[model samples]
Target: MLLPWLVTCLAGCAVILSPVSEGCGPGRGYGKRRSPRKLAPLAYKQFSPNVAEKTLGASGRYEGKITRNSERFKELTPNYNTDIIFKDEENTGADRMMTQRCKDKLNSLAISVMNLWQGVRLRVTEGWDEDGHHSEESLHYEGRAVDITTSDRDRNKYAMLARLAVEAGFDWVYYESKAHVHCSVKSENSVATNSGGCFPGGAWVTLEDGGQKLIRDVCPGERILASSEIDGSGELIYSEVLTFLDRDPATWKQFFTIRTESGASVSLTAAHLLFVSKGNCSGGEEAAFGSMRTIYASDAQPGQCLLTTVTGELVGQNEEGRKGVGRLSRISQVNMREDVGVYAPLTRHGTLVVNGVVTSCYAVVDEHNLAHWAFAPLRLLHHWTGSAGGHVGDTGVHWYSKVLYWIGSLLLGSEHFHPWGLADPWR
Candidate 1:
């Protein structure tokens, strides 16, 4: 099953193809922006990503097994490419359930975490990548998780929306710098294969759908679930669901910790926004551009989650600012972002992707922390940016342009100067 040839190409086989400049991507700016396309949020008392997967019945990218009982869970679509409106499913995946309680949580989070200016509408992509993570990380088998992104490919949304998620009701959360959110209700341990992983007592639960079996375990009493991260180099290891025990229903209803990745697991939602960068090994300049692609997993699998990466064509870039002569491994994710941010733009552009605060490193965003001033949701408009450039005189996409773009939108996207429904074109 290992495509060695493809892997070799990805690992620097050749640079024959010319690098093409794709057009600019969607940006937030001042003006009559489009109506925020809000879809029905996933509700069902946030489960682990694995639970969300199993509930959705996923097998892989476009194939799955579904059931009527789990169809409602699958109805909530994550960020996928097609233009979908409402929570209804046509081109995307949906099979989870959200009672009135779940829906209300989402609506509240949307308003509470919204930046008023930067994040007008949000997209939820890969809410449930169904079996996307490695074995032992499948909450879908237990039915508890979801992923959400902005429909407009907004990176600023990742930081703030992640914060808002805690205000809703979720435990195990992982934000991708790659423009996607992977969440679950049950606190999970993703480092079963790592050295710190202690699961000798952990029992495996078998989840099989369409030729896929998810290997998982349940922790009884108190056990550690850890997630951590290594800085700068993108070595992320952040744990959620620490000190959780599964045998008793009473304790199950209570809060417990699940140890995440150690050393490198900084936060569960580190990769909240997806960013793309390409540099040739042959001593050349790196070509980094932010491109987004969306996929829905709930459709194929009605109550299962299965994630597998696909092979993509290459478009290599050499140091000479020219594209050609190398095999470019294609990579894509929804709502991804760059780890580093420069202050030339909003100075405080959104990247903290959470509506809540970090108690420990891997703890979920708690509602209690949402109101803190230091823990405030990110802002797109700072005095420096406002005085520097308006929308017309703003920087496009270079060296983390999302910050600058968000700043310019203080003029275009925010409603600070006007009241709702007054002169607000976006309202």
Candidate 2:
């Protein structure tokens, strides 16, 4: 009877000690918690396109991504900085063919150098598998070296360029007697050589097809005279005698023409004419004319004609001499009377004046000169006239007005004086 009474009391205690669900609070014995704090939106600084690119640092790397012996070396397309340019040297000519590895390394060198010199562009005069005259063991043959031209023709500038190239991480920097700066990267254990300040002899190897190439300095005041034969099909059969007169390449432009002394004339593409220091034949290899064909047209204006540059979309002025011309599309304008070369207002320096001034001026830039892309038009405008305020960047003007300003700046040549100046504030 005592045992039964004790068990009944224990059961009653268990019920009374059990925990209460509601009295434990909202979060299992914890107080109410607050929601997560909100974060403020980030503020970013605005920058112009050029500054933005520069701030991002080098667009390429110095390391050769493609190994020297790898098959990919031939197929690789290396990413290169836009500021670097490739040029043909006066004596050595230009060689752009390079392994993918060397191209990246070159772009890296260009970026590092540009960091030190503002508005400076690197011109790679030579690269990759040049003639055997350089040396069988030369890094250039292996696509590990390049020849860079100095910013200015001054020897002091060349020295500065060499010093900066060394600072830019080039393993070998050679100031080649004011001609060009030679830079290379070699293996740590491999010995690298530079010419120092001494002038080297027999540095250039004769190009394999140098004999067959027609070398002409395409420039202003240059004339071409050609005589052609025709077949029964009325198509130009071949050119019998083609004569090319030499002119300074510095004066070269986009389109050029050749007229025979016998009143017969043919038009020639100025872009096809290669500017060389010296050579034998001076004409483009015509497709069906057995290396020389002359197209005859009565519309061919007889007289000394000017040539213009055509590469990519930009047609007028290319002082940098970067890419080769695509084709001679059409003769835009011509002046048969005036022997004097005139400037199409706001056009590039060498643009020959024909019939009359070109009504429009277009601003342009190539891959090498992209650093100036933003200011290309401004520079072209500044080359001649004073800045007119209402013309280019006026915030108060209508958006359509601004568009007209750019179009007018690009097309119609400048007039005597336009009321385009900005108003003085609080005047």
Q: Estimate the TM-score of every prediction.
A: 0.25, 0.25
Task: List runs of model 2 lying over 4 Å from the truth.
Answer: 1-80, 88-94, 99-101, 187-427
lDDT of 1 at 145: 45
Candidate achieving the largest lDDT:
2
Model 2 lowest lDDT segment of ten: 191-200
Q: At residue 379, what lDDT does model 2 achieve?
A: 35
Candidate 1, residue 79: Cα displacement in angstroms equals 15
State model 1's lDDT. 0.26
- What is the lDDT of every predicted structure here? 0.26, 0.31
- Candidate 2 lDDT, tens digit per residue, 279-335? 123222212222222111112343322122221223222343222221121233332
How many clashing residue pairs appear in each of the predictions shown? 136, 10
